[model samples]
Structure formats: structure tokens, C-alpha cells
Target: MYGDVDVPAAVQRALTGFLDLQQERLEAIGPELTEQVQAARDATSGGKRLRPAFCYWGFRAAGGDPAQPILTAAASLEMLHVSALVHDDVMDSSDTRRGAPAAHRRFEALQRARSEVSGVGGDPVGFGVGAAILLGDLCLIWADEMLHTSGFDAAALARASKFFDAVRVEVTAGQYLDLVAQASGVSDMDQALRVLRYKSATYTVERPLHIGAALAGGDRRLIEALSAYGLPVGEAFQLRDDLLGVFGDPALTGKPAGDDLREGKRTVLVAYAVDHASEVQLAEFDRLFGRPDLDDDEIQLLREILQDSRAVRACEDLITERTEDALDALDRAPLADDTARKALADLAIAATSRQL
Candidate 1:
């Protein structure tokens, strides 16, 4: 089986080639739309492309070739993800992403520069956020278009499209639940896991695998098996991401340290920390958890508390357990090809083991 960071060279080359083709297609859409499309497409530059890789391998596992149309459709899903992130950052008002200025922030700077040149602008940040939203919407439309034109059979197209649509709804619902949970200070670990499963796992991993399998005309058994593997891996992936948000090196992650704390994300890790902390630690956490004025020293102290309380260790143990379950699922899955199965296993490790 492939290990973490051991993506096959062929897969890497195919993905790169697919991205180039998609970028060209995005740029050729129209002059008026080209700039926005390009901006949206460029926003994908820094991501790990895990979803598209999953789709590609899932296709292979279901007995499909990694050729033009299949790979193109797979790449389109990446664009869809990128579009979601662009809009999400705007909505979250995140200043940085992928260790640099977020798309909205970049666009805000552009708007300010244009305003200075043309003598027009009330609030550049607002204008930029609006523009980024529109651009994200455009990318979503084009993602569907690309999928439609991807040369799959009608049945395959319908199946994949249906899954993709369902993913959108599930993810949106998850996001809604996440916001509600955070606002209400509902720290139930079970509720937090549900939010993670629906919002992060189903869409990020399970549905994408199912979509790929559907495109290749896989049976229901195979689809269910893929989901079985995907759910745990996907949840683990997001859980690792939450850890990174607080403890990850800012240079690697392309964001300020303790961003999740600043945003007050009600992740499972945070909930566990709260549950396990002492009265003194709880007092400190309550004072600083959602405070925007937290300094580096305070964040460091919070990290220490999380470690001393063993929440970090507990979270890591959960990640390992989930990953092992995913691996076991993959092992028992009736994959027709060994290479594809190995690739999928490798992907799970990479998704969960990243530091950034």
C-alpha cells in the first residue's frame, strides 16, 4: 500500500496535466468572464488537491482509465472546492489563507488600488468581498458546466451530478449546524462529530469517492464500501485541520497562529480541551477562547494548557483510531485493482498526517 506522501508519479503528472487543461478552458470562456474565472481558478494554486486525487483513484478502483474526460471531470470537482473556499473565507472574514492573503483580501487590495487610480470607492473591503462572492458563484457554474461536458454517459453524469448536488446541501447544512453549535456554546462531542461528519467528511471524502465510483458505473456495494472508508478518513482530516488551526506553524499553514481560537470554532478538539481543563485552566480558557485581543503569549499558554490537559494527545489518539478504521475498510473493500486500493490508502494517510 502507498504510504503518506507517496503519491504515484503518474497520478501527479495526470493531475498536473488535467489542471492545465482546465485552466486553459477557464481562461477561454469569454473576455468579460475570463478575468474572474482566472482569479477563481488561481485561488486553487496552494491547496493539496486531495479531493481530486480521491476522485481519480476512486475512478481507477471502479475500473476506469485516468484519461481526458474522467480526469477533467475530477479536476472540475477541485474547482468546485476552491470556489467554496473562496466564498467561505469571505464569509468568515479570514485575512489569510494558504499562508498568504486570501482571495477576498487580495481582491480588496486590488479594489483599493483601482479606487485610488479612478477616484471611486466607499469601502474597498466590502466591494472586494462582493466581487469575490460573484467570482465564486461563477466558478460553481463553470464547474457544473465542465462536468456536463466531460463525456461521461448520461447515466453516469446523472449519478455523479446527483451526488455532487447532495454534497452541496449536506455541506451547507453542516455549516449551518456548526454556526449554531458555536453560537449556542453547545460542546457535546457527539454533536460536534455529527457536524464534522456531514460538513467535512461526507462532502470532502465520501461523496467525492461515490461520485467517482458512480461515474465509472460501480455498483451500490462498491459505493457503500467507499463511503465506509471515506467517512472516518474525512472526519480525521478535518480534525487534524482543527489542530493545525491552533498549533500549526503560521508559515506553513499560511494563516496567523491560533486562528481557530480567534474565530472561536467549536471543533471537537476545543470541546475536549474545555471538558478536561481544570477550574483555573477553564477560567483562562473562558477569558481567552473567543477574544480577538489574544496575544502570542496567550496563545502559547493556551497551547500549553491543551497539552497539559492531554486534550492534544487524546485528539491524536482519535485520529489514529479513525485512520486505522479507514485502512481496514479499504482492506476489505472489493476493489478490482490493487494499485488503486493502495493509492486510496496512501491518500488517507496524507490527508490526516499533514502538518499544515
Candidate 2:
């Protein structure tokens, strides 16, 4: 979508350089660890690179130099994102990511192959999950290493680290909250929105921009402007994602249709459905929404209920409102670079309007 964008390319190059150096370091440690390093490489592959773009543009809009250090720092966000995704796939028991085998699934396949050759029986599932967890941990560690060693001045790095650290803490907390929300099966829209704010909104948009602004030595005013813009935009982004998880084409979304329904996510859409559904619709919904074995007919029924309740339309309306708010915030902010402002506007559209 952003074929003309130079910043995503710069971010990708920085990521590649860092991962290549990491692979070399692992090779020096021992050839036995080669496959794990390769798994790390695979897990980091093929994303929209949105977090890095947010960071890059935030810095640029603040009159920060488009230099290697800032680019490297921006790319570090991708590493952190990868870490979250790897662990997320594991936690969600997802089989695929980026239209390929997830990290844990790949490790499972490797373990199975080894066992077949050795004629031994073992818990491939346990081994795979363990390896994937360690790989995710390594990605987080490398993210910190990349930012600290990006050649930014110590003061800038220190300042940026606060946002970065908070991102880690908040996202982790949000993940735990999500697990609890799922287990408890809460249906309140406000409660669901709180999960969205921490699990996705902050880490996805707010903190990346905050980290960039801090690195640029931006004032409190600029940071506040960015928060105003980022929070709503990020919420819209995740709202779009929730819609896609249920209704998106697998070819476009890189996941099965109705995946979110199967997972029993207590999203705002589900909450709205519960509030507006008829008794019969609610009964059917309770039976089908979380069924791991949901068939196409069952999935279609749930989709119909969501539509009948106008939950889908409500979610769409919220997305539009949030997006407009983000643009309004952007317009009011005293951004130094017109190009950066335009880029951010384009990003807001792309983030909310994407099919994938």
C-alpha cells in the first residue's frame, strides 16, 4: 500500500541489518543454535511495519533529523512488535501468521521431524511452545539492545527509553488483562474498550510516537498532540481489526474467517450484540460464538446476528468518529514538517481502512 514510502524501506533495512548481525553472533556461539536463530528471522518477517512508520513520522514531524540512529530506533519498535506477535500466536494457539506457519508450529514441525528420525516419542507440543517462548523473549531483549546501541546521544536514548519501557510494561499488562477478560467472559463495552486501549491502542500507536518524540527532544505540547491523535487512531485501527477477524477474507486477512468468534473474544462488537439481540438470537449466539468446531453455517448465523443487532454498523460508525478525531488532532497540532503531517494523515487512513 505504501509503495512510494521511503521510511518503511529505511526501517526494513535497519531491521535486516540488526537481525543479520544477530544471526552472525548466534553462529559464533554455536552452530547448534542455528535453527533457533533462523526461527527468529522467520518470526520477524513480513509485516505492515506500521509501528516503525509511526515512530519515524513522529520524529520527522518534530524536526528531528532523518538519520541512521532515529531509523534504527524506529526499527526497534518492529522487533518489539514481533516479540508480542510471536507470543500472541502461541497464547492464542494460532497455527498461522503472515500466511505462514507460526513460530510455535514451525518448532513443532522441527521436533516432529527429529523424533521421526530418532524413532523416539516426546511431547512435540511442549517443546514447540517452549522454544517459541524463548524466541519471543530473545526478540524483546534484542529490541532493547537495538535501541540502546543505535548511536543516539545518551540523553536522547535515556528519554526515549521511558516510553519504550512503559510500552513493554503496559502491553504485557494488557495481554494479561485480555486473558482475564476472555476467561471471565465479560461483555461490557467499556470493559472491552479498556482492553483495546492497553493491548493495542497504546503499544500500537501512542507509545511508538511518544518514543520518537522523546528521541527528538520534543516538548510536552508536541507529545500531548501526538497522544490526542494517536489514541483515537489506534482505537480505530483495532476496531477495524476486530471487524476483520470475523468478516475478513482469509486471503486478505491472513487468518481464517470467524477466528475471533471461535476464540470467544469479548470485543465491543460482541457486547453490543448482546445488548441488542433478541432472546432467540442471544441463545443461538451463546451456543455458537465460542465453539472451537464452528462450521460455516454456524459462523454465518453469528455474522447474521451481529448484523441484525446493528453491531457491525455501530462499530463502523465508531471507527469513522475516531478517525475523524485523529485527523482533527493532527490539524490542530503545530507540526514542523508539512510532509510529515501529510504522511501521518495518510497513515491514519491506511491504518483504519486497510483490508489486511
Candidate 3:
């Protein structure tokens, strides 16, 4: 009851219980699936549970009472999130997630070791990618199953299904947009911001809140209010993530320093730097911006180019602006629970200012 609505541990317990049951089902299939099940577990375990927290608080703000049913429903979002992370890492070819090998990489390693021991020949990369995609698909399936079976009555499930469906579609669309942006090799601010809005903003915060509000029978006005508050906050949160990807410490961020720099992500931060860079700075930027083999010094040089261009400052400004917009909308929202409103306000600050 974290002060009124959200309970992180309860969310974790709900997810753990579900995963345990699924693990049993997987193990019964064959011993070869043992590693796969563990990988799935690792993908889902440990996070701030921010989406669940937001959804739970959204329910409270809509005048719903604290109940166990909401926890299971909210925890299902974590499964969906795991699906996103697994697929995103595969797409990015990211080696690590939360300081561990990303799911595809883990799968690749497992298959590689098995093939060597068995003297069986297979494409390790293909095996890893295929397995990771299956893992993501399983998680996606479980997310819907967990939500529908969450002890909510039929009406509540029906009410929330629209938003739930929307989240899935919006996030996938956002991922596609992001992929296209990368392929186009353009760093226009508008394109970057558009991708951020869909990829992170809507699905990460706004839709989950909508799902919760719908479950609680919140009116259309409240849903509108949540959208006003959630979308900007979500954008700010991802903006902070963009900064962390470039400038954060590996220890705190749970990835290599400048992970995005190595990936050559055409984030708004990169766009800003490109826009403001001097000819000499642009020369250096062009030379070292996207090389996957960026050494420590090269990353530092890239950092210098961004900082010198005031791109970091530009991103900081955007985060501050969007967060303020979210808070203002929250203040004006007609929430029944003062406590939930306060919790969300604090969350906005912590989320944008977070080091991880």
C-alpha cells in the first residue's frame, strides 16, 4: 500500500507467481527448455515497476479501492515491457541489458556452447534471434493472458481492453518508426521527437494509465486528463533516458557508457548536436559518431562534441519543459484521490531526474 495505491512488492509477487507456473509448464515439455525458461525469467525480473505503479495509481485516482485484482492486472504490464525490451535489444543488437547480456545474446551463447559440445552445426546468430523472438512472443501472449485472467469481472476487462489493445499497437508502430528513422540515417528533430512520442511516451505511461482508469470506470474526462498529464511526462522520461544513454555512468545505468553512442541512435539529443555543431565539431562528429568500436577516448570526444554544441543542455531543457507541463496537467486533473495525485507528481520528478 505504498501510501495509498501502488505496492511494488505485490506487483513483483504477482509476476513471480505467474512465471513460476509457466516455468513448470515449460520444464514439463523437455529438459532442453530449462535454459530458455531461465532466460525468460531473467528478462522479466527486476525493474522499478513504473508502469504498474502508474496503472495502480490511475485506478485509485478514478475512485477505485485498493484490491488484489488491480495488482495482477498492473503486473501484466511488466510482462509486456519484457517483450518490448527483448525485441528492442534484438533490433538494436545490444549486448547488455541491466548490466547483463541481452536476451538474444544470452540465447546465442547458450546455443553456441551447446552446438560445440554436441558437435552439431547451426547458425548461432540465427538460433539466438529466433529464440529471442519466440521468448518475446511468449511474454506478449502471457501479458494478455495475465490481464484477462486477473480476477477482474468481465465488464472491467472489457472496459480496459481498448486501451490494452492500443498500447500493443502503438508500441509496435513506434518501434517500426524508430527502425525506419535509423535506416533513413536522418537526425531531424521532428522525426526524432515523433519517434520518441510513440516509442516511449504513449505506451510507457499514458496507455497504462488509461487502462487503469477504464478498469475503474473512470469517465472520458478523466481519461483525457490522464492523457494530458501522462504524455508529456512520458516524453520527459524518455528524454532523460536519451541523456543517460550518452552521459550516464555504466554502474548506475546498468549498461556500457555511451551505449546509444555506439548504436548510433538518431535521438533528439544527437539531432540537436548536429544542428548546432560547428564545422570542425561536425567533422569530428561525422568521423566517430556511430562506430560500434568506439573506445573510451572516442566516446569522450563524442561527449565533448555534444556538450560543446549545447545539445546536452538542449535535452535537459526539453526534459524540464515537458515535466513541468505534466505536473501542471496533473494539478488541474480532477482526481478523486489527493494522495494518488501527489504520488504521481513526485513520480514525475523522480523519473526525469533519475540516474537510472
Cα TM-score per model: 0.90, 0.97, 0.97
> Using lDDT as the measure, what is the rank order of every candidate, best first?
3, 2, 1
Please, what are the lDDT tens digits per residue for candidate 2 over residues 177-240? 8888788865788788988999999999999999998999888999999999999999999999
- Candidate 1 per-residue lDDT over residues 1-356, each given as its tens digit: 13332323333444456456656766587554555645754675647777777877777788876553666677667767867788778767889878667878877888898899999876988877987888788667767876787778888899888888888788778878887877876567887888899889987899888888889888889999998899999999998998999999888888898988877788898888888999999888877877777899988888888888888998899899999999999999998778889889888998999986
- Candidate 1 vs candidate 2: which has greater TM-score? 2
User: Rank by TM-score, descending?
Assistant: 2, 3, 1
lDDT of 1: 0.79
RMSD of 1: 3.1
Q: Show the lowest summed lDDT stretch of 10 residues, model 2.
A: 1-10
Residues 1-356, model 3: lDDT tens digits: 35554467888788889988888988899878777668877877777788888898899889887754998999999999999999999999999999899999988998899899999969999999999999999999999999999999899999999999999999999999889888887688998998899999998889989998889999999999999999999999999999999989898888999889888899999999999999999988988877899999999999999999999999999999999999999999999899889988988887789898
Clashing pairs in 3: none
Candidate 1 weakest lDDT stretch, 10 residues:
1-10
Give the C-alpha miss distance for residue 340 in model 2, angstroms. Answer: 1.0
Indicate the residue-level lDDT of 330 in model 3: 98
Candidate 2: the clashing residue pairs are none
